[model samples]
Target: MSEEEWIVDGIDHLNYRAVEGVYLSELNVGLKKLILHDYPELSDSSFVSNVHLVKYRLIFMKNVIDKANKKNDYVRETVYEVTKNQAYETMDVQEEWDNTITFGQKIADIVARFGGSWTFIISFVFLMAVWMAFNVLKPFGLVFDAYPFILLNLALSTLAAIQAPLIMMSQNRSSDYDRLQAKNDYRVN
Candidate 1:
């Protein structure tokens, strides 16, 4: 190969003119150190595989560029820490959120689950039937809530008011968890 076509390090047989070519020894010292620290296995070999090294280098450079463009030090540090710790693939968003939730949030989730089930619908229908039957069949002038059933309406309204907020809370939590899981998945990929 011509002198101009060869890489500066001459370790890997990669063509300098190749589209994605990158030599391990030719990379920035800090970037190489970071990669080596993150992946100790690569440090053991004098001539790291060009393909693997280039892939990691590209990823590192992309992350660095993105963080720099965004002007966010925290994001850059977080990316570096995650890469170093190798925890991107093992992240469990559901388990993490579950562990951090309060007792009230748990109760809201349970209540929302029950409220959306067929059992709740059937039981509620049966109770309403029984309530109306008793009120209608009671002796004259002795009925607590007659035809209009003001008491039953009040109870239903109160239940709706309370259950609506609880279900919304659970749904909001679920949406947040989904967003977190998606972010983790993106990082892993």
Candidate 2:
């Protein structure tokens, strides 16, 4: 126990001097007001110990945290109430679009799927090799199209003209599907 005694401001009279003291004017205004607690006897020129000031700081921090927690709880409750009262339904965009897809669109999607695959690349390379070899080598007098293969060039140009539009159509439908999915998600949230 401390043998020395001191009167601390903002709090009740103290009998021990376990900690040092500071002038009330040395503290920040907010901290000073918090400790004062409307005690009329305290003044700006008064003196208080470090222990009492630290205790009041803890109290102030607790009050602020409690107020923030209460606000968070209110927000959580509001969100819960809004979600509970609403009946929400989310739809699968792909399934719904399948029901409405035209035959041409379906064909385009199938062609697009095949065109983008490794199988298409490997098979296309094999076919081109066979065509060029057949034309250049004459293949035991079986080649009707000779070197610089005009017929093969014409076939490639026609395939490109047709395949490009089919791929584009499939991509356009895919974007529309994504838009539908986004709209469905917006509604659900």
lDDT of 1 by residue, 48-127 (tens): 44565666678888888987878777778877886896644567777789788999899999999999999999999999
lDDT of 2 by residue, 69-179 (tens): 999999999988988988777787778988999999999999999999999999999999999998888867888778788998998999999999999999999999999
The TM-score between candidate 2 and the true structure equals 0.66
Candidate 2 residue-wise lDDT at 116: 97
User: Which stretches in model 1 have alpha-carbon errors above 4 Å?
Assistant: 1-89, 139-142
**What's the TM-score of every candidate structure?**
0.53, 0.66
Could you tell me which 10 consecutive residues in candidate 2 have the lowest summed lDDT? 1-10
Native-vs-model 1 lDDT?
0.75
Model 2 stretches with alpha carbons more than 4 Å out: 1-87
Cα lDDT listed for each candidate: 0.75, 0.82
